[model samples]
Target: MFWSRKEKEHSSKKGEDFSEVIERIKSGDKKLRERFINDYRPFILGCVSKHMNRFIDIENCEEFSIGLMAFDEAISSYNSIKGGHFLSFAELVINRRLINHRKKEIKNSKVIPFSYFGGENEQIIENSISEKSIYLHYDRFEMREEIMIYNEKLEMFGITMNDLVKKSPKHKDSKELMVGIAKIIADNDNLYNKLISKKTLPMSDLIAFVTVNPKTVEKNRKYIIAVCLALKSDLEIIKGFIRKF
Candidate 1:
């Protein structure tokens, strides 16, 4: 259920008034402890169920047990004055423990295919199902065609997509750097109109005129230079073209 901000505020206020309940539990009041569990059982169970998909062999019983334990732990240790409602605080504790439990399960379990449907005798069937699932999701033929087109474009630029992805964020800050250079070129009225009118320009002309840092220019020069080179124009020729505007 979605909780409105106002409803949350009301619930929080109610939780704050439960300070006496918290004290009673902390002081070993058994009846108050049971009452707390009875009231909050559904809430705790809901939290556990939400995260149940993360665990293998998890059942209603297991979820209920984990939720109750989490509830008890929250009750025994919660400090109301720390802030927020008791339910909110308790929910956080329950969810965290449940997540920890799932993480432990993942660490200890073998990586079995999700499609594995039967016992030991169904290993071959499981492998066949897994292979089919991969092939269906990852269209191999279309992927290769796209890769070929990307590589052909990259070849004109003297770099590869692999090289770009491997570069650090500090290594010229790719997209941001290109945008800044574009802005600089657009700031000059003549060049701005030409770019707007033609919708294209030599990459080297744009970069050399706009970029301030020679070092960054040199380091990232290959990408822009490749585009200019692909247009079959020399760097000096491209620079001279930009100088006219």
Candidate 2:
């Protein structure tokens, strides 16, 4: 069920008008800024997580960061002269930023399709069903070993293979952009070293060197960092997985 009548009343705090609260917040009230953030913590976080359709660890979560920033943006950017409720404006800001963040991450991600390593069928010389089964088993074994090693490498970044599965960008255009960014990182020695030595992305340097923005770099930090690690190393097996993508 949606929030009950009582819940709405509690959220309103003595039936104070929502727009009035925004006006007070906008009037250079430092205490209200902190108080409003504190009061609406659940609302902001809940909006983001609900939009993302996942359990958000708002504590240090990227979505949380983006959402709170969007809220701040809404406060500064809102205009009653144009005429709209504060929450409506805030929701629009939150939704747009969340979508922008996702799109940025998708573009920034350098995807290596793990499916390349697996063999489907080849119509081998062996015609019997049993023989085909044997070949399939061997191929399956090879794919499993490759996946295991890939997962192990991902562990260094605190991401599991499962996480990649959930995080894969569906759009081909996004995937292409990610691959292009990965190529830039793979070719540049300084970029590669920062990814390896610092364990963080050189987003500013990359933006200066490549055609990407801070939002893109920040969104896809984990995926880009992981792919750089794979590409820079002697992980030929993992590199092989990247060939088709």
Candidate 3:
């Protein structure tokens, strides 16, 4: 499967000389289609395997089938004069197809079970736990409780639960902001717990204490920070009880 420098150069020259094959394909040549598949099988398989590993849960034969189909599609539609290496162009098409395939599977199908072919078992366990049913059940319950407690605390500062829940962060910035908020709460346990135990505060009053204004709270900076602090306090309390044993 290894190519020497001379062989690599020869392959490149042959690929470049595929201009006629490309034109015939555009004109709908059936045999040239088979030739294209024969020539690019190895390269396409390697590229698909490297990129599509993240999405597919199939064996080597299944992956190869997908890769070959992607290669055939690439050859039929590719134009060499677009200014890059043909293999590179083909790789892009294959990768995109693989990613789209994964997205469709995630959205439409159930979790794939792990079958042992002699590798690490941990990944299988982890993937199993991330199943949609388990995740949705836990996430919905936890998020609802968190929202309720957060509203209760915001009441002391005069903020309504409805306004706070409506102030969710956009997708990209949520995780980092939540982590920072967690650290802040960890550093201030008593205050964090006190806030969580309260009932009603004006939205404006709560925002003023945690942020420069109500708008900042709406932007999620204040809410994330408050959540992080409360989570940290809870963690510490749990750890303290564990230590008593």
Best by the lDDT measure: 2
CA lDDT of each candidate? Answer: 0.51, 0.62, 0.51
- Against the true structure, candidate 2 has what lDDT? 0.62
What is the per-residue lDDT of model 2 for residues 1-245, given as tens digits with 9 covering 90 to 100? 24446545755675344665567778887776676766677879887876655677776688888999898888877754333345655655776676566545444553322222223332333322343444454345445544544555566567776666666556777666776677788788787667655557777678877666678767666666566655654334577776667
Q: State candidate 1's TM-score.
A: 0.38
Identify the superior model by TM-score, candidate 1 or candidate 3.
Answer: 3
Query: Comparing candidate 2 with candidate 3, which one achieves the higher lDDT?
Result: 2
* TM-scores of all predicted structures: 0.38, 0.42, 0.40
Q: List where candidate 3 sits over 4 angstroms from the true fold.
A: 1-17, 53-60, 110-125, 129-245
Q: Pick the candidate with the highest TM-score.
A: 2
Question: After TM-score superposition, what is the CA distance of residue 226 in candidate 2 from its true location, in Å?
Answer: 3.1
* Model 1: per-residue Cα lDDT over 141-235, one tens digit each: 32443344344434534567666554423533564564455446445455444543443443445555764565555555444333332222212
In model 1, what are the clashing residue pairs, if there are any? none
